[model samples]
Target: MASRKKNPSKARRYSVKEKEEILRYVDSVNSKQGRGGQTAAVKKYGISALTISTWLRGGGASSFKIGKTSSNGAGGVIAKLAAVHAEIQAKEKELASLRSQFEKLKSSI
Candidate 1:
């Protein structure tokens, strides 16, 4: 028996500006096409539709703190707080959907 070693690949990180550019392009296409624009963005940008969706939903670049400031500064803290709140909301929505699915499955069984 031969043992194979697994190669781990790191996720590519996009700078705030790059993320904004990708999002702007996605928005433009979505506005013109009216639907399935994310699919188009995924194809054009070589990024997953889920990543595009995260950007659209106030995550990604939108969560980044703008300008240089101390961590304890009001602006920095507020921005961080807002980002956390948005993430919490997104997670809550996902949890609700999973719970609904679980309920459906339980009822069927």
Candidate 2:
């Protein structure tokens, strides 16, 4: 049998602040679900279970028992959140403009 090779990917480095953010998010989600919210971290963040495990292991002591997570997990979540927020804001502005246009059309008729 031919052995499958793992793809080579460079590990991303994260700062202390960034790591805290990821753990914070994880903590927040875990809190809401009580002991059943472990999957929230991975699902919401699109993070892999293995990656999250690594992060938790390296990111100080966690009250919840998880595998591990990298310090960069927080940064990743923050970055994703920022992007989503920007997209939502942009859509809101566009919606406002469309509503205004509709109002103008109605008023003109």
Candidate 3:
């Protein structure tokens, strides 16, 4: 076989949910101290620090808002945002159904 550019070991794929979970842990650690969250995450999660850093820069934690160190009401904001997003998705689906129904009624008329 020809030589391959990539390594034989496959790269691990982490879902958005997984990334968020890891990031949350990292956030908690960083908050307790000052920094080194990525390094700490590397030891705990076994994920590459570079990979986590990339995720952080690439908006992997976009699902949850970051920045606030203290627990406080940050969770509340994320919850509200999620609720609103779900509502918008539901509303969009309903609108599409209504549009379909309207078209059917108009054709019948």
Candidate 4:
């Protein structure tokens, strides 16, 4: 059976920070689901499960400049929250612009 990582040349390199983030996400998922955290991370991060397994086994730990992460799985959640907040801000600004345009058109009519 051919694995998903069939082409070595096409394999993407993950940075130390990325690896740690993925590991944290996996930890978060596993803590909540009791298992299948790697799979959840694969779907969320678009990474292969084999890569996550290797990292979990310390295959990529030697070069890792490990940093502190939240124990409550807030690392992943907080990043996502920040992204959503930014999007909401942008949408609000757009809505205000559209409302201003509508008022201008009404006054001109």
lDDT of each: 0.73, 0.63, 0.75, 0.74
lDDT string for model 1 (1-109, tens) is: 9999887876878766677788777767778988777788789889988878876765434444454532334676687777779999999999999999999999999
What is the lDDT for 93 in model 3?
Answer: 100
Off by over 4 Å in 4: 1-9, 59-63, 66-109
Tens-digit lDDT track of model 2 for 1-109: 9999887986766555665566777777777766433477667766576766676765443422222332246654465566679999999999999999999999999
Residue-wise lDDT of candidate 3 within 26-85, one digit each (tens)? Answer: 888889988988889999999898998876665445544444331225574566667789
- Model 1: residue 12 alpha-carbon error in angstroms: 0.6
Number of clashes in model 4? 0
Give the poorly placed runs of model 2, Cα more than 4 Å off.
1-8, 59-109
TM-scores for candidates 1 onward, in order: 0.51, 0.39, 0.51, 0.47
lDDT of 2: 0.63
Q: What does each candidate score in C-alpha RMSD?
A: 17.0, 13.7, 13.5, 14.9
Kindly give the stretch of ten consecutive residues in candidate 1 with the minimal lDDT sum: 64-73
* TM-score of decoy 3: 0.51
